[model samples]
Target: MSGTSSQGEGSPGGASADSVRRRRVPRAERERQIVDVAVEVFAKRGYHATSVDEIAELAGISKPMVYLYLDSKEGLFLACLHREANRLVVAFQGAAKAVAPSPELRLHAGLLAFFGFVAEHRAGWVVLHRQAAELTEAIAGAAAEARRAVMAEVADLVRAGIAESGPASRLSAEDADFVAHALVGAADSLTDWMARHPGRTPEDVTLRLMNMVWVGMGGVLAGRTWSLEDPGDAPH
Candidate 1:
């Protein structure tokens, strides 16, 4: 049975004539491989530095294969961003799920979930947070969408905190946004800093952020006086 017939093809029943003809991968698995390679390439070379050739090489498929499945380089990077960002969002949402009915606790769980994602998938974070900054057009929009999606959850928490506690509402939506941005910035900066200082546990970083944001947010929204700690009154 030569390779001509659809019966026997490769050596001794190893490859069917039809199999040798060309096995078609399911769309889902092919998409997964494309995304996996895209993540690695984008993470390693940054988005601008990566090429479809590199992804194809890493994926052991033709460049056209990637294009066929994921369109262009921008498309591939965007897909990776969407997949990874969605994963992080889901993780944070899951964490917020088991929260003990306190906005404070939910916020803490959300922080924990975020750090856990950042730690486990540093590459994903880099692509979402770093590489996205370097891209333009639709790619940049993907980043914005992801950033907004994540931040919206935080903002919603803030809104809830206001409604439940009744004081945060006094602050304009702009004021609420300002507070959300500050808390987000502090958490992100601390996470980056925690990565630099390996001696400081991430959990410790998370807790430090938790205490700072939760106390401040809770107090401010609960209408408590804003307490300024003296430089002399705090731990180093």
Candidate 2:
């Protein structure tokens, strides 16, 4: 009797034994999966249009399961925004890591990364672009914080590039700020347009930007422009 009872208690078929071996998802993994599904949903249909139920369904889990993993729809959306913002920021910054590259190349790499991210993370980028209404205070705050960080980095690069180009005694602080904002604004607006058009490649967009701004870009560094000397009048 004792042997039989002990065997049954330790058996793999027993409820307690099954509980011990159950494969419950870790909090991080489950949250990641929830955010992944939420990104696609929010991207296709703006935040207001999305529901936790839809995300749950798309994620192959029950609604209650989604809540258990990520809380309410608002909470889930915020999570998605947070994840994507970090990813994009890292990508853009990483592209500028080449040491001692020219401002033009640095600018080129940064713009390429920006456009590449928007093209790659379609849902995540769309959520950031549109769905302003769906963003609660928390999400909006996080988004603003991320943008400020990127803007600061861009401004720093602009300052460095200008300095390298030469003595820009004319360019004011406000001028630098304006240029920084303009580049960001143009990239973001064009991102939306490029996404919709589908024909314009990322390189095409980056080249167009370089041509438009680079013609006068030297002014940013030297605060002035130098004219080509007449070869015949060689200042010997």
Candidate 3:
């Protein structure tokens, strides 16, 4: 009788564990899982080459379910772009805010965070950097919006730096915007360079950029002007 009771108890315990394993995941979680898989697929294959069927197989769901969650292939790609862009912005803002209010330090922290994101989330970065363009108007617009968001943040930092330099500083809001655009453009180009030179770290890149841009800006604020005639007067 004791043997039979022990067998009966073990059967129910096994059944209960199976039930827990088969429990339905929440809808939001399931959608996230799909998007996560889609990011990898899109990164590897690009938007045109990636297929919904493959994403579903990788995610362990039906293609219909992927459509049900994201509506269409375009929708899934858009979702990936939006999530990655927001994550990048959050990383930059969080890192910048954590440090002292000095604009130089803040910018360095933000650039380090940006490079770190690119290094760590290579797939997501590929989606944002390479795949976003050459798509539909909506897709291109989304990418542009993300760029504008980053540019705005950089502009604000540049503006603060200008203000801190006091009345003698020749830089205005317009100048700040220009500087921001230049910085963003340089960072974008440098990402490709970073990929080639894998040994160089994010810190190394950030320091190089700070020395290039910020140090020059300091000379400009100090009433030191650069001219073609006196090219030698430029900051080293």
Candidate 4:
């Protein structure tokens, strides 16, 4: 009787034994999967509404496993934000590095990269924006800092443009700063618009923006200023 009981306890049924033998995923891969699913869920349902259970279910892992990897819902959300934000920043950096030396061309390349990222990772954008709305001392600070870095990059590009322009069109540091901030704001707003307007392609959005921003820059660079006093001569 003792021998028979030992055999049953050791092996259980075949199915049960097979489940117990299932392979465990690597820690890094598991954490990545959890964050990826969390981004999707958090984006679809705002951060406040999302749950770790849902993320775990979507990721084919246990809730306890998610906690084991990410600690808590907030941690998981932060991880998602970091991952996506890093992706966007890297995309911009890579594109900027690959482009021509012209400042305007570099700016154009960055805009194209930015729009392309939004088009491909809409969910990521939603999470990042949500981070802005639900600010906290810790996670929100990180998110804000990430944005500031991108804005600073834009400012650098603007400064370069100012230097490249003719003396008449060149702007002071203060003016360049203002223009950089304005350009960043416009791009952010347009990204939201693009998300809602599925019919528009990233390339199309980039071209329209170039027409607005680059053309205006061209006027200033050409030493032409528009004013009510002289409604600039009509285009030929």
Which structure among the candidates has the greatest TM-score? 3
Q: Distance (Å) between predicted and true CA of 89, model 2?
A: 0.7
Ranking by lDDT: 3, 4, 1, 2
lDDT of 1: 0.75
RMSD, each candidate, Å?
5.2, 8.0, 7.3, 5.9
Clashes of each: 0, 3, 0, 0
Pick out the ten consecutive residues of candidate 2 with the lowest summed lDDT. Answer: 2-11
Query: lDDT tens string, model 1, 176-210?
Result: 67767887777767767867987876577779887
TM-score of 2: 0.80
Residue 137 of candidate 1: its Cα lDDT?
Answer: 81
Q: Relative to the unseen true structure, what is the C-alpha lDDT of residue 236 in candidate 1, on a scale of 0 to 100? A: 22
Residue 196 in model 2: shift from native, Å?
A: 3.6
Which pairs in model 3 have colliding backbones?
Answer: none
lDDT of 2 by residue, 1-236 (tens): 43333232233444453453353445687678779988998888888878877887776566766776666887887788778878887887788765347767777787888888998898888777677434688878777877776777677767766667655446656766788888888887898789688999888998998787765666435454454674453221
- Error at 196, model 3, angstroms: 0.4
* lDDT per model vs. reference: 0.75, 0.73, 0.88, 0.79
The estimated TM-scores of all candidates read 0.82, 0.80, 0.89, 0.85
Tens-digit lDDT string for candidate 4 (58-80):
88766766776788888887898
